[model samples]
Target: MTEEVNNSAPDNSRRNFIKTTALAAAGFMIVPRHVLGGKGFLAPSDRLQVAGIGVGGKGESDLTGVFSSGKSDIAFLCDVDDRRAANSVKRFPQAKYYKDYREMLDKDAKNIDAVVISTPDHNHAMQAMAAMQLGKHVYVQKPLTHDIYEARALTEAAKKYKVVTQMGNQGASGEGVRKLQDWLDAGLIGKVHTVYCWTNRPVWPQGIQWPATGGNIPPELDWDLWLGSAPYKPYVEKLVPFNWRGWWDYGTGAIGDMGCHLVEPPFRILGLDTPVSVECSVGSVYVDEFKRGYFPESCPPSSHVIMTFEKTNKTKGNLQMHWMDGGIKPERPEELLPNESFGDNGTLFIGTKGKMLCDTYGANPRLLPLTKNASDRTRPKAKRVPGDVEGHYTQWAEAAIAGYGKIELSSPFEIAGPLTETLLIANLAIRGIDVQRPNANGKGVSYPGRDMKLLWDKQNLRVTNFDEVNQFVKREYRQGWSLGV
Candidate 1:
């Protein structure tokens, strides 16, 4: 992170002035992409100039997807860890590499037309917002942001800035989702009332105390930059690269990791909006033989979250969606044969007339009762992405090149924001399970956030009944960093 940021920047005041000037110029001076050729038009030779933040692991694949579209030029690359970034750097040798995103944006905003972000959950909102503020189109990995407030902010920003946007829930563009939509629209499922989505996640550590001892920092890693916007703490072992998902400060736990893929089928088919209420029950860990472990900073190992969304035109009434992770699953649907394989990760939709099930990313969609697969359910009602799930990347890149409103997107921030909020709201309930308060006797502590359903004030972005959980809705960034909204 800091490895590539060693060159000293100008003094704080001058750096701020430069940043302000650069962003202002980038926003106002750059010609709007949509206006060129009067919407949905790009010259054949024109290619999107993309700057990739977090160009490693998922970031690598994401950029590759965009580049493979034959409509993008990978102009710049940024990552906190040099080791993680090596592959991307080698793949696009000409793309300038930087460890600090702010530096790249500040210096190269004019050179970048769009940005592809695949950073950790904690860094997603800030980086995406910075790019959007500079009038750069963005494709961000899902759950769109780490906090509900951040999601709401990014959603609004996408509109205000008038930049083309897409979330990295590639499943949204899959044929299975469109097929499910067609079935639901055709009255096959008959008003989905209850939806169950489950995944075997939290493959990383959770429900554990932070290590008391600090681990030696990797030479190629910059610990401070990796902690962007998060509160300062010494680097610990096995936390970088992937395990950050289990920590509340850096990740959004299992639901955040897989909820977008699993919950998406019912969400899109039913046209869901911000959930009105959410409740969750999480597995507990015992510190010893008696006392249950209370690691407030860590997400629970297992959780069952239920979110209640207001009725949409596609549904008969309000819909109740359940999300389970850490290997916990809902009761098997009775319609299936006992020997049928219930996927390890899948989504099940229960409606008034029947039921439907699909694996992760809405793949292998099938109507329950097993025999329903014999009938022709394929309806070309919903348009399919050219390459299905893999097309998600090119879809965004093309829409970005064609300009906003020129083409439809499967999961723009407008959709991803609320969808992400649903997950984060569930997390509020999960984290609420550990909120400490004085006991009735005023001596020991109690967990008041437990056992109560959290009511959401969607407009206000806060919990109505429980105030303690609201603290998580928006977090203060560490000094010298801002959402830049």
Candidate 2:
């Protein structure tokens, strides 16, 4: 959404505090709003009065982007952590604050035209669905849902509410990513046969030794609220503020954390739908040692998930998509020189005639043809694609303020829902009972693994494996917190 200053500042001191605290917290050089606010289209006169849920961590960044876009008023901020919410209170003193997003939505439903949700994976579907049900546009961070059923429910909710929506896969709007799509469309890399996407997540909270016996919950945080819809458990410090990434109940581990960014490009450009089968080859390490009482006796810390898409009548050919986590690397693409290596995180598309490699976040993609002569310095420079990765936030703000029709949404639910579904399948595969074995074609050759790879009936939004993975596709919600269909 566009970030335009509302000329009507109800509280000058409060506005100043927001600007100053945000600058200090960001630890970046600050520019005055007026000076930084160069002439650009302002948000519509009927700008959205926006509220931010989960206003810590990523939520702060999301807030700054929306405010800067000049299209919305930061009417309220919500977070499970009181300390984090205090920061928002310092900045937007005039805005209301709440510990529970449900309270904020209930109290300010009339005033909040839109909501930006930067909460944990488990909370996304419920929050976004609630906002949509109330007729508020939503901009939710990706992967859009913690599970597959929520993904479908969210897409339907967006349509039913007829609200403008955007998934926070900011990379989807990157100029470089779009260029990668164009290159594929232009046949720069012929008939992509397989794709390998990797990420260096768990960097902040990954691979921790499971928490030892429990301790008292910290007073500053409300451990119960933090638990939210996840099963109730005693508070643990490692699971809070940041460490949630490693846990199964509250987070999606490496796959859900980075897949939206690393895997989206290929999933989009390749027009991948439901996979014919899915399975994971997990690391031997048990997850219990890392965090206390988080993972059940079941679950692993790291895995290599192989998802195969049979040649649908519409697909050009059978395509194999492999996903790796925990600093794993794919077998080197043949096109790269013997010594070449991809970034710690990124996607590699192996085509029939060549290969295309790009950064983990879809920056600096290049086409490597099968034949590269030593004298090929004479080869023309690869075409350049311009982008403003920062512009995506602005794009969402503009769309929210302009009432949907006037502005284009970069990653609407139509695109993001399936993307999230595909990524979440990898999470399910990793937790599945069977470790997928590789077949003659190097595709996943395992049982229960195939159970998670349900045939996706896009038109009907149902899985063919109704008896197996369907239960995992969606989850049961705690009472009073359930998201309705």
Candidate 3:
């Protein structure tokens, strides 16, 4: 299914360039993807040509899902780390390889039909934006972008660019969410008023200071490219491969990593929106016997964030959502027997009548009471996504090849964007949990923002109560990297 790359200037270069320039000057028009083809639109039989950025780890899985769909070909692979890309390269030897996505997109945009991004949180926006501007369909990893502004921008861009888009919260395609919604539809749980989502994440380091000494850079890794959009920092050993999830510059803490998976069920089931108010209490770490570790650069070891959302159609009143991470689990419901599992990563819904819960990826959904099993009358009302979670890739590929509005997706940017915004907002509250304040008594320190309830102005993307933490709303990109571009 691989197509030969257009090494020379194609006849459509001028037209393509004109379209792209116009998009940059005034966002983009909502032109259909099939507009390139005459009449009957794009054929459903056509294969989607996919290019992958960050083609390692989760990125590899995403590409594999696309290939496994039997309706797409993996045409290009890009990654910052050759070591990490080795498996995908071996798997898709016919696919052309590149180390920098910017280079790949610039040289091969015409050859690519869609782009999949699974890089660290910081790089998601820039790479996805580049692809979208080129009129390429995009499937970005969960928590969509590193910051709130990026999330909003990408959300709008999907509409403006008129391209098919999906965020890699594959859980949205799972039957678990459908089952949960069925229970809600059946009134089994009544009206959900409160929700709790938790995960035993941050198996990596957090609440710790950066290493005093930088480590040797891995030969296969492009350190600078890997730090795209994030401020430069010398290489450190454990930070590579995965531990980056714990740091602020690269990761969005544990919540950013798992919240998209765990919190999504509640967000979808409850139809939640931006939180009006948020407050947080985080677990601290101590570097010495004197004081608690205040590694402002790292996320807290654990946290409990409480956000209140205005009532939605699915909710009865103001919705209270609690997020817990770092092995923090909520009190087990009385219906759950001592032997029953509460799950390592899960979401729970508290309704006016009873409560229901599920594991990560919205799996293993169950109602309250140790014996409350699904009866004949408790059939699924919502249709389950075909092929379950992995279908997320095929869904996007087909929609891209078939044009906009062709197929319904589980976690499209429209849905994933708001979900990501909520999670990032929660991060703002977490980041502010211990911001140091200027104390007149300079003997030691003071946390004026400690335990403060942050009032989020979604339209402005700021913490109204604590202004200092608002800086995180849309962080400044490092020199040479721009999300707008």
Candidate 4:
């Protein structure tokens, strides 16, 4: 229960007045050529004024799905929990609420434009890198960042604040994950190798029990901005309005709560990058009675993570991916169909030619051994792919007013920041035995230690194993709340 690492020092005159008013609003920004020629387009009487920042539980279902997808207009609502920002200001009575999202981005930086953060995950890379350095346009949710150098510094501040980003792994804009990425890009599962993907999640909050050591800190909640950048613990409603997803200094457990929606459709129809190694095997162990939570009654209220992707002669080969959560379920391949039921949240893949499954969030995905190899007939029917047309909160309100139109955003932080740095490196391999010690599965347990299996040069994000886990790839802020990279 002691994480705290902000290293402060930002606010360089509010970061150069949000970089000179987002470079003078990107020099008069007008690239909305058509999409009804912007200026509040997505029509329902052209809305989109939005500003939300963690507006209570699933940010109040992503602000009622972007104001019922009439395409936005919530105005402002932030939250460090004043009764869940007064229940989103009683369903946005012309909202203007704020409990400090840096004082509602210093008093509505010219009427928000777009924000919607859905916080907690250690204040998601500092409120989506201060709303993409104030040009706004962000959606952010999923395991976007709670380390791994703030998921590559919020994917390079959303490509240097050009903004318009999305992450709330809303089953990657379903339609069964675009027909499971067009059945793994029309190969109908040929290359894939081994991919599993489970999730029962803590089923509705899991087993890592910890919360009983005093109380009294709920005068409507603030507790230091809900323990803002986390660390100075004490106030505890079992760690906030929704048991902070199993907690590892503030959520990222249960493999960062369903590893970006069960490891995003086999990491985007098998394009998986970075993972020449990673190993985890847990179950049985207890007595860390959860501090800043993240199970440890010896470990394994449910666990099994075995990642292994290696194929860098320019990818498209060696893959392994297995990951199972609480109700653990993998090992059902006799070509499936025993009345087929890879349910309770899903993903399967396992191909050389047949298998692929789906569920939990990606809804109905299929493609099992419907028949082909040495056929008894019946396999020719692969077409269905159009999912989330104007869905995932109107695809982030039509990419915040006409930007990413052909609507493809599902966990886009260049792929949810390396799938949240490989599920927060499995919570640093389940707290790498509190940083060295327990190995033969004893203290907290550990693995992936040939110096955390090196190899991740993603261009130059570093770690060919630079002296072992390169200080676990970033973290040491906590002064005025650093995070500038």
- Worst lDDT run of 10 residues, candidate 1, spans 36-45
In angstroms, the error of model 1 at 191 is 1.5
Which of the two candidates, 1 or 4, achieves a greater TM-score against the reference? Answer: 1
The lDDT leader among the candidates is 1
Residue runs of model 1 more than 4 Å from their true location after superposition: 1-44
Alpha-carbon local distance difference test for all models: 0.90, 0.72, 0.86, 0.68
Clash count list over all predictions: 2, 24, 0, 16
lDDT of 4 by residue, 1-485 (tens): 12332333344567898999999766546433223333223333346788888788788888888888876779888787687777678888888887888887876665667787887777788878877776677888888877787887887777776667888878776677666666566666667778888887774454555566758887777778766776675675555676766666666677777778778767765667657556565555345565333344223456776778865322247877778888888878787678867687787777777776877666676666654434323333433323363377776776676653345565667777887887776555554423433567465744344234334555565456433445545656455665544
Q: Can you give the TM-score per candidate against the true fold?
A: 0.91, 0.79, 0.90, 0.33
- What's the candidate order when arranged by decreasing TM-score? 1, 3, 2, 4
What are the root-mean-square deviations of the candidates from the true structure over C-alphas?
12.6, 12.2, 9.9, 22.6
Q: How far out, in Å, is residue 196 in model 3?
A: 1.0
Error of 1 at 407 (Å): 1.1
Would you list the clashing residue pairs of candidate 1?
1-80, 1-222
As a whole number from 0 to 100, the lDDT of residue 265 in candidate 1 is 83
Ranking by lDDT: 1, 3, 2, 4
Would you give me the overall lDDT of model 4? 0.68
Please provide, for model 2 over 37-84, each residue's C-alpha lDDT reduced to its tens digit, 9 standing for 90 to 100.
222212234565788988877888888777877766888888888777
**C-alpha-based local distance difference test score of model 3:** 0.86
At residue 97, candidate 1 shows an lDDT of 94
